[model samples]
Target: MSLREVIAQMRQTMASLGGEAAVLLQRLAARAIRGELRRLAGAGSRVWTPAAARAVVDRLRRMLVRLVAQLGAALGKALTSAAATSLADAALFFETGDRALLGHVLPLRPVAPTPAQIALAREGVFKASLGRFGALLVHAVEGAAVATVLLGKPHRAGVDHVALALRRTAAAHAWELQRIAETEASAAYNAAQLEVLLAQDVPGDRMMKRLVATFDSRTGRDSVLLHGQVRPVREPFFDSHRGHFYMAPPNRPNDRELMVGHRPAWGEVVVDRWPVAEDRRAAPAPAATRRVPGQAIRSAKNLRAGDVLAAPGRPRIASVAERGGRIEVRTEQGLLLYFAAGAAIGVLAAS
Candidate 1:
């Protein structure tokens, strides 16, 4: 098949899979929230008064509403940049019939859960529990009088009945609170899984196999292979926290290296050459201006701060750095570029 035809087929397949996955995740999240609420409400039925039960139900309603909104936002944001790139790279591999390109495109590792995600989960559970307790307490005192009236007892004797009711209500509330905490933790972990998926890295080997199978079926070819034997080298001076890797090319000099996948041993490297396109825009330029061992030049409007530049003889990759009127270009290997403003320099895109 033609490269364009292959790319079109790949795009269609990826869109279908990504959309299906998204819908499934949304449904699962909705079901989980509903199930938790139902369980809490069922437990609340043991309370002495209807008002107390209603309060518990109402609190659950609010919690679910907030959780849905937060999750929607998170999922939307995750699908945009990193997730999109991963899908595109897989498509590119189909287009070129190159497996080495997979190294640059395929995610090699699953990122560990971030501290922020952990904190968010803990905070969500804590707040949900506190809200449940408050709702129960608000109706606890009124429950006592209602219990007494229903019991047909003297006012002093009714105090004992109210006490007994309170004890039962508290115990039920505690149990429900624990259930909510567990549900929240599960939801958090599921959301994390979704994040990993959106980031273009499937969680387990089984899922990876499924992904490869889908790709092969869509392309009418079984050429694709997943390699788990290779280790990925970390890209230096980049965000190690994100665990980015440089999948080394066989013949390309080290400075022309690609920051493609995440963790290593996740897959095999296929193609060595970076693809360039006229329609594609460069990734968002880096914001910080730092000094490297590169030559300095005057700034120009066409020059972006993070645009990678290559000269005729230099195999090293140089990045544009702008500070006021001065523009400095430096490479990771400490090479400098000395050029005049508006010099006809070639701009390279990140693969």
Candidate 2:
């Protein structure tokens, strides 16, 4: 084939590989996430348990390992005419921990082609499918690269006819193969990261409460999960901790995750059906049931510095507050709250 046509064919090969590899990597990550979620749901816990939480992180690490091998194999096939590339042997690993997510892709010194890549060189150069006659130029100039480094000899005695006018097509092809491999792996890794972000903001405040409960209070994981959810959320959200985007019960601005399965209308006119607490469901759980017997909570004005305080809906946590001038809430984290005076803050127990 004419050199122009051969170069055009190689370019076509690269463009095709980019599209196929991008789709493949994206699909692999999404499928793996779905599989993990389905498996978690099947495990039969109404809640996302501690084991499931750890598994979520662990699964990401495992996914990376599989991604590397699959990407390697895919690149191998694409770069090949009749022989495979050693892209799969690129060797990638992950070092993930509680607060650490690290991945390693071994350095590629492709100047010295591996056994498989050498075969690839032979196929591309001698076979004339991709490298064509032009590729003979570089190998001859660069100390006979294709023969010595790739073929393990000075030159192919009779087969390699070194034409001075030829270009360095084989070396360029090998470099392109390495670049494609790197790009594909990166796309897959980015997809997995998105999955983790979605997991952190996993759509239910109740579920998230249970998830954070699994860790000790000292760990402060509730905030961590909340912070990680920022990237995935499109519409206005209540809080990262709750992960509910549609409508927050308390004074929360809302949209997004709450309306799951609906096309994301980033700034849609999603005003709530009723005024904030006008909906019975939005109202706080009854104080009678939440309160301990004989411990009626007084107005914020009458409460003292050491008084126990609780919000209307949440009864599990009791905060020892400085004073409830406006608002004071003891959530999963027992931090002292300071609210504006006359803000209709907390319900305090009579001393």
Candidate 3:
């Protein structure tokens, strides 16, 4: 076949492919959005009533709008690159009259971003993060209000105080809160997908679940645990200031399960259980007492079998039984404590 004829044939093929690509992209976008909405509905139903579910969807849609707006430039550049490649191929067919010449013009690759370009991209992501944080703050406030109405029957005053404190604390650490949002945004950018930003399984989602569970517990409402949902109570929950709170089983005095709070800065989740004298007596000594020269356990990964570790606000010491990505600590009462990877653990005695 003549080179001119081959070039003409290739141009026709490219034109057909381009049309198909556009249709595919549009379909993919539609499916992605619908799938996202369904996922949000499922997650929202776990913690919210039907009316509240609509609010969750609304908040998520706003966040998605903000993300799309901030990412406009990036998306535009991608589209431009695609269009340029197509134009280059068409131009090559006219000039060279050879199919092989298409590679010279098209290069088969997009131009890489320079350092300045990367900086600009990061700045856009940061702005998106700020928007996300705003949405999260608003959601938190709304959730608190809903919780107060649902759980504040007997202890209305206490619920009101908690709601106020949550809002105030979020406001107080506005900078830190934005930082968290930026981190999440950056991660989503690196993944090159808006789905990460819109996903219902993010940390903020988990925090909302925790808020719902905490409210239910406080209000004496029975909560149905979702399958495979690891309760946050297993790990030491920290506030913005890093003050740790641990969950405790019902004790003799109160006979009510407690989410014990410590350190006044974060405000306290007032529970019926008070610190009993026996609790202090039962607690293992601080890690500093067991530190041997140059053998101090610094990270959760360093834990080994036979090491006694102190859990925050828990009286009984747990002995480290296994160590790997996750560390397992078992108390004398056969209670198994599972620490996720990178979870901070206080070493009471290094063995």
User: Against the true structure, whose TM-score is highest?
Assistant: 1
What's the best-to-worst order under lDDT?
1, 3, 2
lDDT of 2 at 254: 12
Q: After superposition, how far is residue 122 of candidate 2 from its true place, in Å?
A: 16
lDDT of 3 by residue, 125-226 (tens): 444544564455455555664554454243334233334544464456455432333332222222221111123223433211121111222222111111
Candidate 2 local Cα displacement, residue 49, angstroms:
4.8
Q: Tell me how candidate 3 scores on lDDT.
A: 0.35
Candidate 3: residue 271 Cα off by (Å): 88
Query: What TM-scores do the predictions have?
Result: 0.27, 0.24, 0.22
> For candidate 1, what is the lDDT?
0.37
Cα lDDT tens digits for candidate 2, 218-256: 223222222212112322222322323222111121100
RMSD of each: 16.8, 27.3, 25.4
TM-score order of candidates, top first: 1, 2, 3
Candidate 3 residue 167 Cα shift, in angstroms, is: 35
Clashing pairs in 2: 245-255, 326-345
TM-score of 3: 0.22
For candidate 1, the per-residue lDDT at 219 reads 22
lDDT for each residue of candidate 1 in 1-351, tens digit (9 for 90 to 100): 533345345434434434443454345444544555344433422323445434443554465456545544443333332244433454444335334333343433444556355335445444555455545643663555554455444433444444455446655554444343333332333233334433444344322111111222122111111111122122112211111222221111111111223232434332312221222222232233333355333233356545554333333344666533334455655544333344334444332
Best by lDDT: 1
